[model samples]
Target: MSVGLVVVSHSAKIAEGIVELAGQMAPGVRIRAAGGTDDGGLGTSFDLVMSAVVDADDGDGVVVMCDLGSAILTAETALDFLDDELRARVRIADAPIVEGAVAAAVAAEVGGALAEVVDAAEASAAASAMTSDQNSPEEAVESTSSDRRGSDLSSTTLPPSSERPEEPIGANATLINPSGLHARPAAEFVRLASTFDARITVNGVDAKSLLRIMGMGLGIGSSVRVEATGTQAQEAVDALTTLLASGFGE
Candidate 1:
């Protein structure tokens, strides 16, 4: 089931950062945010909250975490917005915001229950220096060690899986170079692309991305289109021509 996480925060910046962090923590999980930047504003309203909740998980169930009193109250108020059926599946969890997002990501990625993720988030916050100071020295030390261990695990963010719908192709990009696409040509193509505001994506039958591009084992005579969009999209044609002019890496 496709699960969506709705992160509600007082500040859009905080909500944005949490969503970005969640994307890193869990590659495929869908996370949505609803918030206001000003102080004293109650969290997401009933309509927005229900929309985010419904948008994220559909019928798969969503974990909603909010900040502060009115925000919490606001979430409670929003529940009435859900129909009896969706309401039954919705859960408004109370926890420290950022920690909740992280735990949610981990839980979503590891297939753990949402309840466990909420528990982790609350626990993490309670022991956080910004919050309660409830841990004993030994427990603190162990938690510190575990935290360090988590750091050692590669924190590199994976690129999102293809989310864009396919557009109809106007031309067949065939790899016609005798030498095929290699490091220099790939670099040249990427460098050419850096000049434009256009969004460029390279996908082969094998896959998309530079890593996958190289891994596709395009030995020579590869014809790949330098597709582009935006004001400088035409530049993609020029840039690609410059790179492909040499007939790819000879």
Candidate 2:
């Protein structure tokens, strides 16, 4: 089964509304809304969050997105009470509820693993912060690569430089779809990107990251540079270029 999502908020309407919005982008994913107190008041309820978590999990895992401090607290509390097996597969995402839920849902719908879904949710927050800071997509890509490199180095030894591709395989394509890289097309692009063993960038943002690709704000006729580095670099670049040239089948 694919990953699932639980949106927790203090207001029942807010939680349900987020679910509706995210569902539009991830029609096949299971998403549950947990909001308000058990008494139907405006507060997070442990029981409600717990039930939503249970309902969302379909054997893959569940990612929980919370609106605010108390909502997070409630979700965390519920997680603490879950069985060991279930608890091990759950995560509390530190991200903006609405954006995080949408990103997480799309990742889950695309069959992302639990960690990837959590990364998608957190990436929403990072993308927002980068936008506010007016960081260039190149800078964002560099930052992401640096962070990933650091994480990898911390866990394992890196391959020798000579074993790596010296130059990135690159190609250019123009966005032909009227709407450009919107949600659905962006999701499809990310899904395909994730299938390869290469690291790819589109106009200087992580190609496998849905939020980063969409954050490029690409529009019809916009030029896109697809670049990849790694064992499958050439194949990845070629495939992405072809997909873009086809307008993602729009």
Candidate 3:
């Protein structure tokens, strides 16, 4: 089963808007928005957050994303009131609300576990920061590796390819979709990349990260190099190249 998500914000519109954006990439994942007070004012509500946690939970666990300080406080207080069993499965992601929710939703949609979903959320911020700091793909990969290694909750890192000595499987494909690698197409590419038992890179960035793929800002007619290393390298490269050649079914 897929993990679920909850978006908690001080403004109802903000929370709902985030949900709408994330939902475009993850239509099947359950994403509940807990925004504003019960009276529809501009404040967080413990009751609203609590109910959202319950509604979003689907036995796989829930990742909660908060907008501001008070929203986090309300979510934390709500978690405190939950039973020990339920509380064990809930996590308050240390991430930006919009980016975190989108990343978490895409991870959950791809059947990631609870910890992986949390990692996706937290990594969103870290990836953005690194991209802004160093615009090179090598730097992005190094930053991701360092962050994943440092995080206590990160159980998964980029698949290892050091043991294999041969050259990685590679292919080049042009973006034919009118919108290029936007949110939805990027999410689809990431989802496909995650299914393989290989380390894949598109234009040198981690292929399995939704945020990294979108951050590349590829446009229509842009040529992308897809490469992979590991046992399933050929399959991963073939699948991705085929998808890109097909215009991502647009």
Candidate 4:
């Protein structure tokens, strides 16, 4: 069966770089990312990660990779909850999320089978050895075997609406968490809101960045009220409500 690949990393840029380089090595595969945020958020949720995996796989089987150990465990836990059909299609790569993700994605994105592509990726990353300032790939690889809080600022930021609506709804959201809106919750919230066209502005000290949202620092069981108008208003609210009610499926 055709297989897809998922890459998880503390930094989306690192994850992307791996995929880009891997494409050079393996031009016949597919890959997708699940971690942090392009808009800039830290900490990715299992549901969101699963969503990314599902998106990349596109049927057949999929290989999953992660940067930090917690992310890997989170990925594993997420896999456990996936629908049996999708769960059957996914397998974790015994490799670095950064290097392995790119390698596997390059293979699968081009139409390679999941296992073969992952095996090939393992070989390639082993040979190439993704490196940081350190000459060894292990330095660049990061460790998925254990959890480490890297420099990812997992917080959300929302800039003042530059484009004012002709019809505006003065919507206000609260940070109900004991801590307030940090890391995991922010990532989950962003993932949920992305599904609908709701213009979600995470309100907090630095509420303009996706990373800020992830690291916003909301306390326990806090409520962050999000307001949006337009076609996606109601649907966005409902979807977010469901996600929040389930603890963002954490």
Best by TM-score: 3
Alpha-carbon local distance difference test for all models: 0.60, 0.87, 0.92, 0.58
Any runs in candidate 4 off by more than 4 Å, and if so which? 23-28, 37-39, 109-111, 129-250
What TM-score against the true fold does each predicted structure earn? Answer: 0.48, 0.78, 0.87, 0.44
- Error of model 2, residue 221, in angstroms: 1.9
Q: Which segments of candidate 1 are over 4 A away from where they belong?
A: 37-43, 126-250
**Candidate 4 per-residue C-alpha lDDT over 1-250 given as tens digits, one digit per residue, 9 for 90 to 100:** 3576677776767667765654443444466667675455676666667787778766788787777887888889888888898888788777755445544544454455667666855654543432222334565456532234433325535345775463422244444444344444553455455555546554422222233354344576555655556677767766655555555433
- lDDT: which candidate is best? 3
Q: What is the lDDT of candidate 2?
A: 0.87
Clash pairs (backbone) in predicted model 2:
none
- Residues 1-250 of candidate 2 have per-residue lDDT tens digits of 8899999999999999999988877888999999888888899998999999999999999999998898888888999999999999999998999879988988887788999999989889887666556576788898899999888876887679998657888999999998798777887788788889999999888887777777778999999999999889998998888888898767
TM-score for candidate 4, residues paired by index = 0.44
Q: Can you give the lDDT of residue 2 in candidate 1? A: 41
C-alpha root-mean-square deviation, candidate 4: 17.9
Query: Which consecutive 10 residues in model 2 have the weakest lDDT in total?
Result: 127-136
